[model samples]
Target: MKIEAHDKQIQDIFSLGYFQIPRFQRPYSWERDEVENFWNDIINDVSENYFIGSMVVYQERKPYFGIVDGQQRLTTITLMLSAIRNSFLRLGEDNLAKGVHKFVEQPNIDNEAEFILDADTSFPYLQDHIQSFNGLKIDCDVGIEEQKLKNAFEIICARLEDEVPTSNSESGGQISMFPVDVPDPILKLKEIRDKVLSLKLVFIQLDNKSDAHLIFETLNARGRDLRTSDLVKNLLLSKIKEGNAKLDSAKESWNSLIRKFDDASESEIIDSFLLHFWISEYNYTTDKKLFSAISKYVSEDEKNANDLLKKLNHAAAIYCKLIDPGAHEWSREETDVRESLKALRLFKVKQQSSMTLALLRAYYEKRLTLRNLKACLRKLEYFHFVFNAITSQRSSGVIATTYSSHAISLTGAKGNDDIQAIISSLFNSLRTKLPQYEEFEVKFLELSYLSSKTKNKGIIKYCLSKQFGDKFGGIDINHDAMSIEHIISESTMKDGLSSDVVGSIGNLLLVDEKTNSEELMNLTVSEKIKKLEGKGYPLAKALVGEKFPESSGVQDRARSIAQHLYNSVQL
Candidate 1:
């Protein structure tokens, strides 16, 4: 494996050779912010030569190189050069325009101008608009890479117009780099061309495909900080033999997964997907240990890698549904299962993913019915509300272990009777660990749940919303407009009771801002209770006859409310 690392000017790198973005590579996805940052960095730095970071290329043959990294920067630079060339042509500086265009495209043996950068979907767009002397607006239906190229071109053109406009333009404006009418326009364009051509970049060339893949893994792990999922992908891709059928199949499956998670960051979506996938397959893997766990189980052989990839492809569908319950097609076909998953998302207990993953695996394997899946979800809801959300016995690790254990047990079961027994044993196993009614009520009363600004505010809101959960279609409160109201005002505490009790669940109600200040503020306890009785929230209505704040009567009322909330959950 031969390797060379040295510095090359931006112009020299693209002067004669051609580079291809591999089919497995992600598309050109740099957005406006990244383009603007690159532009500003070049203009703001005062050094004689600005060094953009490393670029790794695999020397395929004589002049064609496969880009292993740095596609984003190289693509953006080409767009800037294209903008400069177009600007000069618009200014009627034909000689300067031709000079700048040479850096963007090189002539082939046939003497036709060939673009240096050859992206899969973005190459045509770049060739048509960016490689042309005339700038054209793109309004056609295109993929994300094409859109990104268009956006970069527009930004570069706008910036150049503001910084160094030509004489024939409508408003000949010259701003930051030069005072208005400071230098010759043609000379200025030539200077910009020289600076761009002289920009320094580190280039690493690899001799063979295996060496290129190794350097790709090493560089991303240490330098650019590969997202965890991308690291897993690189590892798996490295295992496949070159030119194998599984390579294309794996790429297709991986690309489909990325498209499904288009709205989320690759790290977040893929990491979460991997966690659920591992749990469903192996029954035990934490978020932090996911990649390592996978690395241990999936051997560095073609068959094992292919099997793992196939499982990942299948599990990716279930993982997408777990992230977005509404996007699941089954959500439309099965109402109960849909509602259960939606409620899980609303709850936002990420640890519950273990149990949800288990239930989904059962459903997919046909060992569990849709009815049983909903039943299992109810048990999860009860566990989350009572122990994870409401009580002091909260530990995500405990919940994860419980669910993971049950998943393993379920996977090994023989028949439907065994499946039912395992599901029954799941609840029974946690009976001793789960908080009972009295313990739950006591903890619930002690909590400053509604008044505290903790995340539990959402959980309490969920509980209150479930009173009308069916009618309101599940926790449909406009959170931005909601507030926690005190029946006995903070300013009217006569007994000098601890201020801590002023905001406890005993005196709290969820209300709109207007109602809190107008009807309930500064009222005597009995007057406030009278006003509260007329309010619509069930928690507020339950507080009609309580005498004073934080009294045993209020605690009793809180206990009752807690019991009511517990009963309201479907379990």
Candidate 2:
């Protein structure tokens, strides 16, 4: 395939043939920023000549051009040409009149007389001038009319007559108005026209006689990474190896899908489908192994990948249905169920537990409704709690367990079996009772630390603040924006109390920021307690009386406060 730059006349030379785009090609609209930048480039190149690039046509027995890229440039050029043609008609340039007519009209034998008198012949020289003028006309704030086109054309003609430097000018003399430096807007546009005509873009032309599908696949696979949609297209095209009829059918099917989800971008659909394959189909035993598995699905399954294609198509349809209000009722239940299952699958992947799947299957077998499914979800939350606690303790050198033994450890009173049984029983009760509240409440309470003095109020306040913001006005406790403050400062721990006692959960309380700031680093616990008492805040008295009812003295009082805070935050 040969590549060469085309002149400004290339627009008139190559017929776009009704301007139909290929079905496989991505859509026309570029991102807003890209369009703005292109426009800016055109404006900047008004004086210097620019070449837009050559159209890479596949050389078959009959010549045909397939735009590899630069479609946006080509379309803009067409619009520019239309503007110029209109401008020429308004200007009464007798010699240029016939040239403009011919430029706009297709040559016909019967119209030879009209063609001779038309603006067609002079178009090659005058087209750029006319186009430049037309660009200025459009950019101006003047009202849109045929007169604007004529005025723009006249401006270009005048500029050409007055400013463009003559070739016959003295060799050493400095020309004030060279074509390169002309201030004329029409001249500037002509320069842009010249530059666009001269621009070069890389295009790989394949022999049209060769199998188009094979060529397309080779280009895609060897060039940029194939998107999921591109892969699906390749898979569909591969099935049409025998006849043109199959290829047509595949094209129709692809177009139908595009029409169905007209709003989704090519990239959005591709990435969403890829996520589906990764989460639902790929085996993720290890992170590296999982990626390798997904890669194989793309590279190896070349020919008989129709099943995968169908799955993607189904998912695309489902996604379209999800976003369409008209299809909402039909998809609501299934969509919710699918999302819930996805969440479960994610948990299983992260936890590396087959028990997650087992629980899901058990829920399904019991004909669990959404409520029952939610209960199962709650049980999984407990599993996460236990797993996280064990992992943290083990990592910190507080405890250790072998993998084989750990999986089995929840069974005996403190083993895997017992834990599973507890979860199973909880799920059964939830399903039977159709519990209105969250089933994880008990697990949360068990894992949560309680304040001995304030009772569950402190625990409830903490959880409520996390779930809903402080503005949720039902709680009687001062739910004003509060930070967790430690009674003992980590920096000044020279007292008998250990560092653990300073940072312990029991020593923490939700105090207002002003209160914390006022106490600062210098104030010791005893001093801070006195400040609170002076402020008429009952927190210190409450902690002493309710949190540590058994404590007899001040030392005991301080220890009890620390212990209560720790006990309140178990898991």
Candidate 3:
């Protein structure tokens, strides 16, 4: 494999050859923010040269070069130049227009016009609309790639018109790219042209296609630019032997992982799922190093790529259940497990994936009983509440890690007793570090609500939901649908209560949004409580026809509710 590296300015680079985006490459999808950011970077420092990163290309059988990476940047740059050229032409700056147009397209040796970038299906839209922009057709229907390309073009034109003087008089006639005096439109265009031409990139060229693919994988793996899931997918697929069955099986497994989290976007699900899978296997914390960790794991036995794919497929199904248990239709034997999963979701306790994966594997092996799983989940919810909700801290105890390890150990257990023992040991160990009733009571009482702190309100709402569950017999209050209602309006400062005292957890209840807006505000504590009458939530029900003449009375009520919460969850 012969490798060559060189530097080329954008002007010379785009002028020399036509680049083709391969079918495997993702389409142009840069949004308005990204376009504005790029343009801002250019205009912010127009006097000096800037580096725009690197591009990987290989010589195809045809004369054009195939871009293996950096297609998004290259395509956006071409569209930007097209927009600039059309803007110049509209202003009747023919000399400036021609200079910008030359960088976007050129006549070939056969005298046929060729666009500098050929984006396959997006090529026609680019040629007719983007390259030679008249008025953007408002009713034109296009694919996502074409739409994004058009959006980018519009963004560039809009930004340029803002900076440079346009025919429109709505914007103040004072046109300035900088805080100082405004330059002539032609002069500003020339400055932009000169700056873009001075921009440099690392140019990599390869002769062999296979070698280019290897380089693409290596570059992506070493750089944080690529998604971890994409890198891992490429590694697994490339390592498998070239055959229809093996390739199809690997593809199917990857698709299954994607489809597992139907509610989440592809990138979000795959990246998070892979991170959880990594944690389960190694118990190592990571953010961007996931791809490197996965590569190291697969490098140990690359020939077993097919086996790795199969394991991932099975794990994906369990992962789906972890995210949304009620969505997955499990058997009657798994009903208790599903309920536990549902409770975990209601508590909004994510980041237990390691323990979740272990539980899932144990149930898959039929070693864990339904009752024990529910017991473990209930313990986990309480532990999470104490550590996360009340204390506002993560699970830092050594026993927390042991929960995952112990749960994994339960997968191969011999009987129901073994599974129960593991579950008991994990919870018992965690309970040793758990905050006692007194500690929780103090934190609960100290948990003051801030109208601005939405998360605090969410925690308080969950507490009310739990209280409701206890009193109303499976009333199924959707915590998300409920809003925080202050019995003593902080805005009104009812009963001379200060904002903090009025915002205390004791004065708060989760009421329906309609009741909160229509009846709660501008009311005295007694009147609001009367309005809360007949609400299913025990906290709301308790408040009805009650009077708190002083702030201390609200504190006393809050303390009682806190004590009940602590006693209910005691191991």
**lDDT of model 2, residue 385:** 31
Which regions of candidate 3 are displaced past 4 Å?
Answer: 9-53, 60-69, 85-151, 162-200, 213-227, 240-270, 281-285, 309-350, 357-374, 394-400, 407-421, 450-455, 470-483, 486-494, 498-501, 511-553
What C-alpha lDDT do the candidate models reach, one value each?
0.70, 0.41, 0.70
* Candidate 3 lDDT, 1-571, residue by residue in tens: 9878788888877866888875434457678888888889888974577888898888866568888777877887877687667657666666767778877877877988777788755757777787653536444547656777878888887887776655442323333433555567767766776776778888888886667667777776565446777677777766665567335556556666666665654466667877776566554556577777777777788666677777778888888888788788988666657756776676676567667777777767676656666667776777777766786665554544575477456654678787677777777777777877777787887766766655566568767666545225655456567777777777766446587688788777777788888867777766665555555435434543245555667787787777666766656
**Per-residue lDDT over 1-571 for candidate 2, one digit per residue giving the tens place of the 0 to 100 score:** 3334334334344332222233344433333354445545654664544445544334443323444344444544443444444433333232343343343334444443211111221233323334332323223222122233344334433433333323233323233434554564334334544444444444445465234445554455533434545545544555534347345655655656555665554465445434433443333233224323444665575543445555545545544533342433434444434433333333332331323333333343443345644455445443333333212212221111111132232222234455455555444432332221223332232322222223334443443232322232354344545655555555545555454345434444566788777764457667766776677555534455533221124244444443343233222
lDDT of 1 by residue, 237-346 (tens): 76755566445656666767666676554557778878766775575877667777777676645587778877777777777777787765774346657656766776
Which residue ranges in model 1 land beyond 4 Å of their true spot?
A: 24-37, 44-48, 110-113, 121-159, 166-181, 240-247, 286-289, 295-300, 327-333, 392-398, 408-414, 432-439, 446-457, 468-556, 567-571
Better of 1 and 2 by TM-score: 1
Instruction: Tell me the deviation in Å of residue 143 in model 2.
Output: 30
TM-score, one value per model: 0.77, 0.43, 0.72
* TM accuracy, model 2: 0.43
Taking all chains together, the TM-score of candidate 3 against the true structure is 0.72
